[model samples]
Target: MSRIGKKAVPVPAGVTAEIAGQAVNVKGPKGALSFVVHDLVAVDQSAEGIAVKPRDETKLARSLWGMSRTMIANLVTGVSKGFERKLEINGVGYKAALNGKVLTLSLGYSHDVLFPVPEGIVIQVLGAKSDQIIVSGIDKQQVGQVAAEIREWRGPEPYKGKGVKYAEEKIFRKEGKKK
Candidate 1:
């Protein structure tokens, strides 16, 4: 039996959860999100909360039991409190700005990088130097993807330890040449 799947996901106040067939819909103050659970696992909502059970004692069903429940939990949390990701830019002349829905980045390249912001995601530039970025959205995956795309513009280097990275991320440094 999966430990995580055994525990019921309690729906918080002001959040509503509805299970229709294999799909679960979660609506809250933040927004609304739905997920279609896999066929191997069955999901249901009771007074206790949401419960997930496998139809049969099979390997695939057992493996997916916990994941399905977690996905549902994430949906509930996302629709309520939402999610956020922070990014930091290093090195001189490295900065970022938001013009309308587009994110313009200066990462020491010959030309500036222009990233169009997609729907359901918001980007904010922080600090006087504009070296910090905050990506927020109700969808966990979308926020993470946007942060990752921004970091990809100029990843940190081992020697100089300069470039874009997550706020809590640490970069391992390497020694420079003796000469």
Candidate 2:
């Protein structure tokens, strides 16, 4: 019943996929990743591509069908190309610097905030002014989580729109004092 579930996931040319029972392992140019499919859904690989379907007609099985298929797709994409997220800091004295595995942030605070980078992820500070930060990893979820954690230290304010925010994010500025 799910459109996304019915669609087969085509494995790219450079990627290798191995299915062992409910676990699927994928290896590609970027890296290797693995995921376990839920029991409610079934996975099959054919000459055409990888197919996912519900094991039964029950509601839970149907709900997991699409989700399982998407998970496999994500795994393939992640190992093949990896993922990256970019954030920009706005405001005077707001910048980021990378020292070894530590990221130092100056966001108008009296003291600099030091963040330790995690394994399997790379954080780079770009821009001549140090306003740009790039987070990259083979795992899409890990890349997003690291980026969100860095942004959480100083989110953009509605009034001034000054803070760390996604590179493509747009902040809705609020009107200042009406006096």
Candidate 3:
């Protein structure tokens, strides 16, 4: 019995969740989202909220129990409040700008790196130096994937610690060479 799976996910106000077959559809003020649950886990809704349980005591079923529950929770939260990922660009000439649906980055490259923004995701460039980017979307997976792709362009280096990094991320700075 997984602790997280055993707990019921409460449906918030102004949000509706429907469990149909192996899929769960969630709709809220922000947007609508759906998730197809695996057969290993059983999902049902009660007056209190949604409940998830493993079909059997098998190892695979138990492993997916908590994960399925968490995925459902993410759908609910995402439809209601959405998700956001913030990235900070560090370097002398590193910066970012949003042009319509395109995100242009300057990471000491010879030419500006143009990143085409995908649908359902909004990219906003902020900060006084225009080095901060905020990626927001109703889907958690898409938001995270887009953020990761952007970070891959110019990952933070261990030496100077200059590159793209999460707002809450801490880069380990290595000591300089002793002459």
Candidate 4:
């Protein structure tokens, strides 16, 4: 038995769930989210919570059963509470700014790098430090993907530790060679 799949997902107040064909739709105060279940997985809704089950004991079905439950739970929670990620820029002269929907990043390049923000995702420049950035959205996957793309522009270097990184992430610094 899959522990995660067997667990019940609690339905918060004011949230409604509907099953239509192979799709499950959840609507809450914040927004609405929907997902389609695979053929080997089944979803059942009750007054207390929702349950996800696998049609067979095969390895693939077991894995999909657990993953489907978690994804559904995330969708329900995302539309209700949303998700956010914080990023910090390192190195001198490295900074970030938001102009409309574009993110202007100065990462020691001769010219500023402009990144267009995706729809439904909001980017905000926080604090006078000029290095802090906050990305927020109702979809968790999109928020994480955008953050990763921004970090890829200047991935942390082992020697100088110059790049964009998570606010609390730690990077190991290499020691300089003796002359």
Question: lDDT of each structure?
Answer: 0.94, 0.92, 0.95, 0.89
lDDT of 3 at 28: 96
For candidate 1, the clash count comes to 0
TM-score order of candidates, top first: 3, 1, 2, 4
Query: Which portions of model 4 show Cα errors greater than 4 Å?
Result: none
Clashing pairs in 1: none
- lDDT for each residue of candidate 1 in 57-164, tens digit (9 for 90 to 100): 999999999999999999988988999999999999999999999999999999999999999998999999999999999999899999999999899999998999
Model 3 residue pairs with clashes = none
Candidate 1 local accuracy as lDDT?
0.94
Per-residue CA lDDT of candidate 4, range 75-168, in tens? 8888788889999998999999999989999998899999999998999998787899999988889999999999999988878888998887
lDDT of 2 by residue, 42-154 (tens): 88899767899898999999999998899899999888888899999999989999999999999988899999999989998999899999999888889999999999999
Least accurate stretch of 10 residues (summed lDDT) in model 1? 39-48
Model 1, TM vs. native: 0.97
Q: How does candidate 2 fare on TM-score?
A: 0.96
Off by over 4 Å in 2: none
Q: In model 2, how large is the Cα lDDT of residue 35?
A: 91
